[model samples]
Target chain A: GENVGLHLPTLSVQEGDNSIINCAYSNSASDYFIWYKQESGKGPQFIIDIRSNMDKRQGQRVTVLLNKTVKHLSLQIAATQPGDSAVYFCAEISDSSYKLIFGSGTRLLVRP
Target chain B: GAGVSQSPSNKVTEKGKDVELRCDPISGHTALYWYRQRLGQGLEFLIYFQGNSAPDKSGLPSDRFSAERTGESVSTLTIQRTQQEDSAVYLCASSRRPSGNSPLHFGNGTRLTVT
Candidate 1:
């Protein structure tokens, strides 16, 4: 079955440091990728997204890099903050369907 | 102006009982989605509705899980003969379109606990 998985289940980073979370997807037909942040007792919040046509996309203090050859995706957060600590999930959208398949999620713990 | 909203922020039911979760998408949004999140897990795609067209229920786990949407507005997910494994946070999200660029806005989700 097609699936998306993260390299780490949890990552701890110090405040003011850059943090990177990695994901690998199996489906070659997937064309769209997104990153979501979910806080305790809250729903997942969309952060940034990238299309197959582009290898990278940047948002406020956040960047998403997509590597098609290796089927890898990464989210980089600059100057990690305590409020940024949450469960981060990477989702992939197949070209044949609009359904979004989410990864296991990586918990980011920012040490202040 | 409001994001997606869901009913019964928390639900406590017993095994073999049936439960209904409701989702109200943002105004004028044509796409609605339902996802399940188990404890310490990621989101599980369940079902999706796009306008008046036939719903894409392919992601539904089993026949025990069912969902319906009226037009492009509200949707209801009904779990029949729920089991302990059904305990999880049921989330509803809505997007402007079914494309990849359109980001989904999610509701707080209904936390269900089957005893």
Candidate 2:
């Protein structure tokens, strides 16, 4: 069975600092990867995504780096703010399927 | 212009009862998905519907879970004889297409608590 999972369950960071969340996936055929931010009592929101062809993709204040060779993915947030506190998940899409396999998720806690 | 919407934002039911969760995806979207998230956990892929073709229900935890979609529009997920472990947030999402390039638009989700 294919699975996408994270390295950590929780990450605590100070405001204005940088935050990095790591994820590892088991499926080598996965071609698309996405990072989502889920706030308490809300749905998962798309943050950024990277394709297997590309190693990196950047958004406003977020960056997603994919290492297909290692089957690893990471999300980096710059100048973390209190509002950035939420659970972050990494999802992978297989080349043959439309389903997105989500990681266990890492909770980001920003302290002011 | 609206995003994905789910009905019965919160549901509470006794054990052995059946529950239906509805999802209304954004107009014109061709792909819909259903996921479950238990407390302090990640999104569990339950089912996916792409266009009018047969759906991929591989992620469904058990036979108690089933879903249906009318054309490429609204979808309903039904849980029969729900158990306490069935308590979780049921999320629905829709994408412009079934391709990897398109990101999914999600609804707030339906919280189901089985007591």
Candidate 3:
């Protein structure tokens, strides 16, 4: 019954612009969150992750923000590039189990 | 050469046939997971294996599905009497620990199509 959801099914952004994708999760008990990127014909690749104890985490060019009060999570990509075109997914893992539930992906299309 | 590995990247078979998908986790990873991704849908958890503990099969859809793992090694998911609805990408992922906090490393899935 753990359901993680995305706010949008797709997003379009011009190359070099910033892109933001949002996700909503139902489990308040979940303590860990991760963002992944999947390219055509490839599996999901880990981009960044954050613990519930922290509100935000940053990686090379991606940032993950978690809002426990609203049960919302978002991923921001800076200076989006054409190579960044892919489906993005947010996953959650609760303290009770090792299973990581994934949300429906948001496809990001970057126009060069 | 250091990531999860899956075999038979693609497979096609008749509806009545049986198919097995294989997953090889990273060298020292102890947690392995199997998930199904249907067209236009999110990944559906199928099974999980950790160290020497009993595998958690809660996510399996039916009795037609079965999976095996030996001592944190390779895993095989077998589907008996596969149906057309079984057509999907079977994704396998592995994590270094069973702490439920580590991020997972996924392998390109095996795309199965039951005609």
Candidate 4:
């Protein structure tokens, strides 16, 4: 079975500080990894993604790091804001499968 | 361009009853997927449809759950003899294609509450 798990269920951070959410995946064949943000009463939104070939990828204010050797993935948010408070999930997909396997999710709470 | 659309933002059905949830993917997208999310839980893949190929239903929880897609436009997920444990949010997502490189865009989801 393919399992993707997060190290922490909930992470609280102060505004203007950096936040890092960690995820561990069991499938080494997973070639693509993605980070998603889901707010209350909304669907999960794509934040950033990193391919197996790349160790890191960056977006507007977010960065995704993939360590294929350890089968670990991470999402880093710069200057965390109150609006960034949401549930974050890391998903992985292998070349053999079309579906994405998602982790349980980490709740990000930012204090003003 | 409009994003993926799901109907019946919320559904409440009694146990033993059946319910149908709908999804309309983005016009040009050729892939659609259905997932379930329990309270404070992650997305659980249920089914996937791509182009004209047979849908991948390996993720479906049981025989009580089934889904259908007409071409690449619309999809419907049906649950039979729903149980209280079936209460969850049914989310629909779509991608331009089935490739791993394509990112899936999601819909708000239909929150199903089975009593």
RMSD in order of candidates: 3.9, 3.9, 3.8, 3.8
lDDT (CA) per prediction:
0.88, 0.88, 0.88, 0.89
What does DockQ come to for candidate 1? 0.41
Fill in the DockQ of model 4.
0.43
For model 4 the local lDDT of residue B89 reads 90
lDDT (Cα, 0-100) at A75 in candidate 4: 95
Q: Write the per-residue lDDT of candidate 2 for residues A84-108, one digit (tens) a residue.
A: 9888988988768788888888889
lDDT by residue for model 1 over B78-106, one digit each (tens)?
99999999998999999998867788889
**Separate DockQ for every predicted complex:** 0.41, 0.41, 0.44, 0.43
Please estimate how well model 3 matches the true structure, expressed as its whole-model Cα lDDT: 0.88
Residue pairs with colliding backbones in model 2 are: none
Docking category for candidate 2?
Answer: acceptable
> Model 1: how far is A104 from its true place, Å?
1.2
What would the TM-score be for candidate 1 when compared with the true structure?
0.93
Cα lDDT tens digits for candidate 4, B35-88: 998887889999889964545888899999998988878999999999999998
Q: Of 2 and 4, which scores higher on DockQ? A: 4
At residue A98, what lDDT does model 2 achieve?
88
lDDT for position A89 in model 1: 89
- Model 1 chain B: worst 10 consecutive residues (lDDT sum): B50-59
What lDDT is obtained when candidate 1 is compared to the true structure? 0.88
List residue ranges in candidate 4 displaced over 4 A. A1-8
Instruction: Give candidate 2 misplaced runs (Cα > 4 Å).
Output: A1-8
Clash pairs, candidate 4, are: none
By DockQ, the best candidate is: 3
Q: Considering DockQ, which of the candidate structures 1 and 2 is the better prediction for this target?
A: 1
